[model samples]
Target: MHMVIYALVEASTKDEALAAGKTVFDRLVGTDAHSCAVFDYYVTFEEEDTSVAGKARWGDLPTAVPVDSDDGEELLDRGWEATKEEFERNLERVREALDEFSNEEIMRDEDLARHAFHQVGAYDGPMVFLYTEHASGIRHRGQLDRILEESENPWIVPADVHF
Candidate 1:
C-alpha cells in the first residue's frame, strides 16, 4: 500500500520549501530511505495533481476533526455508507479494547493506541510536520518540530510513499 505524507518545511517560496524538505528528510530519514525518494514526491499545497495538495497556502490546512462529529463523517464519506459504517465499526472495536486495558498498561503500550485510533492522521496545531501512516510520521514528530523551529514560514507538502 501507498500513503501520502504531509511534510512541513519553513520557507517563503516553493523552491525553498523543497530544499528544506529534502534537507530534513535526508537528515532524519536518510538519503536512501525506504519506499520513495522524498525529493521525487514532494509537492506544494498549491499543486493540483497530488492528493491532499488542495490548499493554496499553508494557512489553509484544515484542523483535525473529531471522529464522531458530523465533519468527521463528511471527511470519511466517499459517497458510500458502507465505508463510514466499516470505519465506525473498527473505531468501536478499538474503543472496546481500550476499555479492557488499564490506563497504565495502555500508557506502556502507546503504539497500540496510536495505531488503533490515528489511522487518518491530520494536522491540528500551529505548525504541521511530516505526517504519514499513523505510526511512521508520529515516531519522528518531536525531531521534526525541533528542526522546523529554525524555519521562517513553514508549510506542508504532500508526498506519496509506498509501504
Candidate 2:
C-alpha cells in the first residue's frame, strides 16, 4: 500500500514553516518505519525563496540550474535510520523559512496550479507549497518480494508487487 500526504502548512514566519516541517517529519516517521528494522531512514525537504529569482513563467526558459538528487541510491536502499533523519531535517528547514517570512498562508485554490503554470504564476501570496514523492513503502514492498523469491521467508510477496 502506498500513502501520499501533501499539505499546505500555515505558518506566520519562515521559522514556523521549519517547525511545522519538523512536526510533520516526526509524525510520518512513526507510522512509516518498520518495527523490525534496526534503523530508520528520513526524508529531508529543501526549498528556496523564488521571490527575486523570478517564478517559472510560461514561454520563459528555465535557468541552467544543475540537477541534484538528495539520495544517491534508490528508495529501497535508503535504510530506515537514514530515511528518518533525512525527513526530519527537510521539514525543519522549511519550518525555519516559514518563521522568518511570517507568511501563514496556504494556496487556497487547487486550480491555483493551473493559473500559476499557464497564466499568473505564484501570486503575491504568503503561502508556500510542499510536496513529497514517497516511494519508500513501494520500494520496500518490492524488496521484500525479491527477498522472498530468493529464499523461503515467511513473508509472502504481494501479488501487487510488480518486481
Candidate 3:
C-alpha cells in the first residue's frame, strides 16, 4: 500500500503549503495519484518522535531494518510467530481502552490490529513494528509506548513501513 503522512513544509501561505505538499506527494507516489488518498486542508495533527526514526525527526515515520536479510511480509510473519502472546495482550488492552466505543468500533479496531499484523511488513526491528491504517490510533500512542517500554523486545509503531 501507499503511505499516508501529514508533513510540515516551510510555507508563507495555504497555497504554498499545498504546492509544497503536492510536490512532495507527487515525488513520493511517482505522480501516480491512484495509489493512496491525497488531500489538502487546514489541520493540526500532533506528531511524536518515533524510536526507530529517532528523536530528532519528529514527524517522519521510522525506517525498517531487515531481519536476517528478510524484509516485507516475511519479516512481519516471523515477528508474529515470535511474539504472538504479547501482540494479543496488546490488542486486549486496545479493546479495553476502546470500551466506550460501540461494538462495531471495537471490532473494527480488532480488525485493524489483525491487518496490522498481516501488513505491517517492514520496520526497524529489535521488536516487531505495530502499525495500522487508522491514523486515529495516534490517540493511544502512550499505550503503545508503555507496551514497548515494558517489553523485552518492544514493538514499534513505525513512522513508515517500506514495501
Top TM-score model: 1
Q: How do the predictions measure up, each by TM-score?
A: 0.36, 0.21, 0.22
Which tens-of-lDDT digit does each residue in 1-163 have in candidate 2? Answer: 2111222233444345444544443433443353222113222223233322222111222111111112211222323333344445544554544554433332332423323332222111111112212112312235444433553211100000000
Candidate 3 per-residue lDDT, tens place, 1-163, comes to 2122332233444445445544443433335444342222111112343343223333432233222224323434433443444445655655554555566765676546534443233221212333322221222346444533443422222233222
Clashes of each: 0, 39, 3
Superior candidate under lDDT, 2 versus 3: 3
Worst 10-residue lDDT window for candidate 2 reads 154-163
Checking candidate 3 for backbone clashes, the offending pairs are: 61-159, 62-159, 64-123
TM-score of candidate 3 to 2 decimals: 0.22
Mind sharing the TM-score for model 2? 0.21
Ordering by lDDT: 1, 3, 2
Q: Counting only residues 3 or more apart in sequence or on different chains, how many pairs clash (N, Cα, C under 3 Å) in candidate 1?
A: 0
Worst ten-residue run, lDDT, model 1? 120-129
TM-score head-to-head 1 vs 2, winner: 1
Model 2: how far is 32 from its true place, Å? 12
Question: After best superposition, candidate 3 residue 82: deviation in angstroms?
Answer: 23
lDDT of 3 at 128: 35
